[model samples]
Target: MGEVTGEVIVITSGKGGVGKTTTTANIGTGLAKLGKRVVLVDTDIGLRNLDVVLGLENRIVYNVVDVVEGTCKLKQALIKDKRAEGLCLLPAAQTRDKSAVTPEQMAEVAKELKAEFDYVIMDSPAGIEQGFKNAIAGADRGIIVTTPEMSAVRDADRIIGLLEANEMQDLKLVVNRIRSDMVERGDMMSAEDVVEVLGINLIGVVPDDEKIVIATNNGEPLAGDESLAGQAYINICHRILGEDVPYLDLRKKKGFLAKLFGKN
Candidate 1:
């Protein structure tokens, strides 16, 4: 509604398959649901999927590389989300690699998008390479998404170091795909364990839910939905907006946990 000078936030994971793109889609949609203008930039060039996750892949006539290379206007490359009113997507060029756009060019794009939207969320590619660099180039803040695994936590720590080295200190963490039963059985790490290892402020913890797979397959973000994972993302949005929302209790029901892990 009101004019907003957007804040560019990069959603990154040093390791792939940790739901970084999913987090971007949901957070952008969540912000839109909160009446904020949100744009999701897919910076994972050559392997772009944010558009797919948001179901805007078919509508993408131009890509972020086009905007950087002057092949199209910034607005022309942005595909609007059909479900969320104020949500848009600046998809990456599928045919081109990360080298197609430099960090400076990505920063310029972020600037242009921020001038119009309330929040510009960039979905960074996996690994600490040029794509990751470009993703964080225009970001005012960063959120690292990881699963409750040692490998994911290790990568997240590396990402945090890189982000802080870039002088972007406002970082947050989201632990995804948390299986409470596994944690109860000591078969998997807990969200608290991941946080203690990464040493960052935890923004949200998403339980392992089949609904996430369904939503991804359906090209819909479950941010505002009633599912546990969806509510977790909504809580993340509220925390991003400076609300002191408490984290979700991801512990399984007593009966379910007892049945699955033989715990009381």
Candidate 2:
């Protein structure tokens, strides 16, 4: 593939606690690290958490709802990241619900942002309700995040089906929190197994790392680090830029340590 121009992509996971916000924050930061102008928008109204993931929760004065409601200009709602100079965030409203905005409004906002940035990343809320519809309305593609567990995979499958039904042809998968040792010991699903079940193009496979928790607590993104999960996020960002990267080998070893520890 050639160098990708500006593209709008929604990072969505049908179920909650599947690392959707973290995927958004890290991928945005990773693209910014490559010197690309990226804008991350939070579409999880009322239960907004993207701001916290990016460590800009306190900086959000205006939000996406504000822009859609004409309460503030689009530029006024953007919070620039301190670390990634080329990255910005459009936070979600803490007081609003899914009813506060419509799909057309989201498409308009995305269309507006696409004029200036090289990438527009939307962090979608869980479920297949109006919120999901609103989040995916204006996107050129999607990055579906899921864990190795059956529940997350099931939800991801449903999300993929919905995207396909909407004719969103560029949907990709990101298997987050992969337990490498577990896969080796036949405990968890391998990346190949996930691809087999989803039957979709794979973009990334991020390992479950303690550093992610640490980074979250520090309000920093793991994309800046070279941890197992961090590298995966960075690679996915490159792939979004149309770069081809071989999938990382997460199931390389299985020994006593693997048996001593529990599988994720």
Q: Which candidate's lDDT is highest?
A: 1
Candidates' C-alpha lDDT = 0.92, 0.91
The list of candidate 1 runs beyond 4 A from truth reads 1-4, 253-264
User: Candidate 2 has which clashing residue pairs, if any?
Assistant: none
Span of 10 residues, lowest total lDDT, candidate 1: 249-258
In candidate 1, position 46 carries an lDDT of 99
lDDT digits (tens) for residues 78-166 of candidate 1 = 88887899999999999999999999999999998999998999999999999999999999999999998888888998999999999
Q: Which parts of model 2 have CA positions greater than 4 angstroms off? A: 1-5, 251-264
TM per prediction: 0.94, 0.92
Model 2: per-residue Cα lDDT over 73-111, one tens digit each = 999999999889999999999898999999999999998
Cα lDDT for residue 190, candidate 1: 87
Clashing pairs in 1: none
lDDT for 263 (candidate 1): 50
